[model samples]
Target: MGVQLKSSSLSPTVDHILDSRRHNSCLTLDAVPKFACRVKYLNLLLLSAMPGCCFCEGMALSRLLLLVLVAELAAASSDVGFVFDGFTGEANLSLNGYAEVTSEGLLKLTNFTPEMTGHAFYPSPINFKNATDGRPISFSTTFVFAIVPVYPNMSGHGIAFALAPSKELPGSMPSQYLGLFSKSDNGQASNHVVAVELDTVKSVDFADINANHVGIDVNDLKSVNASPVAYFDSREGVLKSLQLISGEPMQVWVDYDGGEMKLGVMVAPLNKPKPQVPLVSFTINLSSIVLDEMYVGMSAATGAATGCHYILGWSFGLNRDAPPLDLSKLPKLPRQGSPTKRSTEVLAIELTLAAIILLLISTAAVILIIRRRKKFAEMHEDWELEYGPHRFSYKDLYRATKGFDEQNLLGVGGFGRVYKGVLPTSKMEIAVKKISHDSKQGMREFISEIVSMGRLRHRNLVQLLGYCRRQGELLLVYDYITNGSLDR
Candidate 1:
């Protein structure tokens, strides 16, 4: 993780204090800091469970530490910044806003089914440290998505990458808000919603500029900077406008530079560069509007004119010369939503239980390995076998049957398989009754065999030479018992 980023919903009170156009809004925070602090601390439990075992876990602590520091820094200096790349659930990532992994390798957001509203955000908070008080850090994000109309050639609303202070919006209108603003906050200046709207349907009320145009929304829905959706055609060294809801995977880039506090977007994949001219460019300062930290993620909605919103992949880079947005390197689309959701506290509990189970399993494994020695009866030096009835060594018996290979298998019994093996010392052939691990009645049968054979001393019947038991693998050594029980 290059830096920590946060994404979430807003409370009514905090929004009022930060909601102003003046360079200063007389802003003060009590709950934001407390919430940020609590969030940062809860994340540490993740590190305790994951002890850097694999590629994913190796960077868990450092990335979480960056989040913790940014949360603290937001309390000290109002400036904060964070970056997220891909929604593939690495680095303690979870779904926040309104999205779920749908189907095998597919991230279906918004309306995967009918009558649905969806907003998905990264669990982390995004805070950019700016050079000036009113300026924001230069940030860029690239998201790959596909918009499929519920009915062919018909789609409503679209998606946006938003920076807000909270993870949820209560009762937000589904049609116009794009699931971005709540019912009380819609059309209100105090909304604190900054987004690059990808409008697909023309609206007189929203002043969409036109259908399929990219527009930057400030505190409200109207676009301060709007442009027809287009992509850089590097092959022709030119620009071309394209329909956003064309039912194909499309890429959109959002870049904000601190020099002028301007934001830019491009509609092309990683193969194409950020064009010299932006699809939409507007000037503004996040420092003036954004709270101490903001949640950054994608939001999409489908109303009566519905479409299925999908996020194939996503990434973000904040502050200090972050790398160019690359869509090629992302993993496959989501297979299914997280078994548990993190926006709620349930995710932490799930991970905690899984970690505990893992620890218990590992401890049991360690104990078993220590106790696994003396596998062969001959390997047990202190055990007496010479006085017994021609006791056989485990390893010698194993070799006589080629490590209990299937070819030497004589027949299948209720408890286990009987394999043909020749005694090493006596050169006498034998049928070994082996108790398998998966046999449901194996333990009961093994006890019966041991008891029944121990009491008998008949020579005419198959003599019980000896028995071996170690780590669930039980074998009864007897005289050449029932040779060739099965032909093949």
Candidate 2:
């Protein structure tokens, strides 16, 4: 597939070059150098034809051609500028010291290891200056990083985004020097280093503004310009302070304009949009500090009080805005040890307590159910089995009479209250009499008399079915007469 751009009569030659690169895939990496040369000569020819029209037209077309060339170069192994969401399986980085690509795909600079210095650089050097005039060109870079200290308030040295002539910086010291320079060569011009530092610990010799600040350094650890870590909130239109050792990820943007010769540094919480105002801005010419060809990389160091420094994602552009990082895809930061561990233990303990409470509630419910079942239990005696005319249980008789309810009452006599009911199982109608007895006489004697009386059945008289004895009440069951009550 190829892209097509509308051709204009303003410049036919420029349109031809654009068409050839888009429709024809022949302008590969090998022909890039030759193609670029041809564009330069064509620019002169266009300007000679029409002075004013060709000047503006040629310049605009040149920018378009430059974007195409840069896009092609970024796809190659040796990129002028690149973007890395993570470092996993990446072969373009040269790492040293404690630097490594973690299993979580983080570019770890300084780990929990103390007194260590680490450096990681792009495999190839980038052309920072113009070929015609040796002046530093405009560049922009942005990265998401984090500084996690062992203690809450304490931290080691810091980290820096550095551009050096060589990939490796020999004889650099850790701690306050920031792995960029030693005490002896602190301000030497021959060092030729331009760096933007995210310093966590202040050094008196370097005249650091505070323990946490972003600084711009050239050929020395002493910052030429520095400001506390903060971002300008466009919505609220105010500045907010940030903590470096809070173990949270933050994003930083460093942009330099060679035309105005201004350098600006800005920082905000991770996933936030870039701030409109820069935290630290200074007027400085990097031409003297940065060489023609320089390696862009990061450097970090740890003193006695160490911490883990990580780079989650990075993007850089030579003369355009760096591509924005996809925050959702970046690797997650490692969990803090002490706080995370304690929280986990507390969660487990809470779950165990809840389970125990649930089990206790379940056991108590079962015991209550068994106790309630026994409360309504029917009383049975072995002696009652001897004399019986189908002795109905207390529970069955109680149910037949609907618990001797007043509503089912047939009549009330001096001996007891008689109630009319139907047997649940046999569907036979009957009348039950409930009489209160407080006698200490033998229960078998009373049951025997009642059983014999129940056997005396006649056609004209009501038949006695059975008798039941409970707590302090004696119940008698008889056939229900549907005609009329004797008293009525």
Candidate 3:
């Protein structure tokens, strides 16, 4: 008959397309298998088109695409590295990581000086070059190192982290290698290298022996060489002269914020949990090197009499492609307290003195007013003695002036109004002077006119016959003179 087949023993391809079943009919089997296979392939195509339907599958595909994108991005960014070669050409290697030169192989690096040598690590005999054509590499590198002696009396040379274009190693490295130190015939100093030096060598010019320090060299090779653009010992402890004995590891960190071109340095002891003791710190403008490529590496050398130095481990990180550093993380200083209680008391005393002055002025004003009133009253009484009181009451005075009518007014004076009237008692024409209550001069003028007129009895002069004072009003009676005052 036809080929015998068990449902459980179906081929993988066929099983994938069709469910378990056993049948001997060839026509049914062929048609069913064909339909099942077509359906399975169609479902796969639909799933691929509608990716959301397969959540897990879609996520996996997305992640793979993301990884590829990130890799492409990183490759496109600037490349950072370290160079180690003779001081003649550019260094071919680009290195980034933790770097150190230790006494007992504690921190080791690729290019390190052998032990028991009086020379420093990364001896100047070994020059590292960094070369990039047009693209500038932005990176931060640190050097952590310690000196170790072959014998108890032996000391090692100093080292430097240098940025240089040449590959030719210097001939005469100083006692500490003083990284980049070289003598010149000009006596001005060798102007070849730029370096940040960590010097351990003792000098009388420096403050102390165990002093730690950091310095920036521009166009100079010797440690003591003078330069205008260099900053040594600053408030931030960048080029401190404090020394660290052999076998003690010191750590330094240099950071450059790309936007500001500011380079910052921080130093600390390797064993401490906190960065309490800072060895070096500073900021440099990197705008000039924005387009220039630089080699990031360490360099050291031994003098004619001394041996080679040792460099243990070395590494660096390129932050040129990384995000900008946040300035808010820096520490803030404490605010000072307010002035002391003694100062506050002094201020209070000054204020009290001013208040006393003001009080004295007010009291003087009041005394002046009282004295003026007393004088006015005495003058009025004197006028009454000379001119005598007006025999007429207030009613008579008002009637005589026609209830002080405007039509009866003779003229206006600075003090009050003068009105022409006929007194009923004397049946004689006269002038009634009404002094304004609001005028201080009106009161004085009334007293003066009455007193002066009452003293004289001359025909040519105006006669002051009587006067009335009541309810803040003053009335003066005088024989009516046909002519006005001489001044008028």
What total of clashing residue pairs does each candidate reach?
Answer: 26, 0, 49
Where model 3 places Cα greater than 4 Å from the true spot, the runs are 1-138, 150-156, 168-172, 176-179, 185-192, 203-212, 221-243, 271-279, 287-291, 302-309, 320-488
lDDT digits (tens) for residues 301-377 of candidate 3: 33222222333334344543222222222111111112223345677899999999999999999999987655334
lDDT of each: 0.63, 0.76, 0.43
- Model 2 agreement with the true structure over 63-179: per-residue lDDT tens digits: 565556555543331224677877686536888888888888899999877788899887666666654455667888898898887767788989999998877788888998878
| TM-scores, each model vs. reference | 0.50, 0.56, 0.34
Candidate 2 shows a clash count of 0
Of 1 and 2, the candidate ahead on TM-score is: 2
Best by lDDT: 2
User: Local error of candidate 2 at 167, Å?
Assistant: 1.4
TM-score of 2: 0.56
Give the alpha carbon lDDT tens digit for every residue of 12-98 in model 1: 343343232122222222333444443433343233333442212446664775466555644444323444344433433445444
Per-model root-mean-square deviation over C-alphas: 26.3, 18.1, 29.9
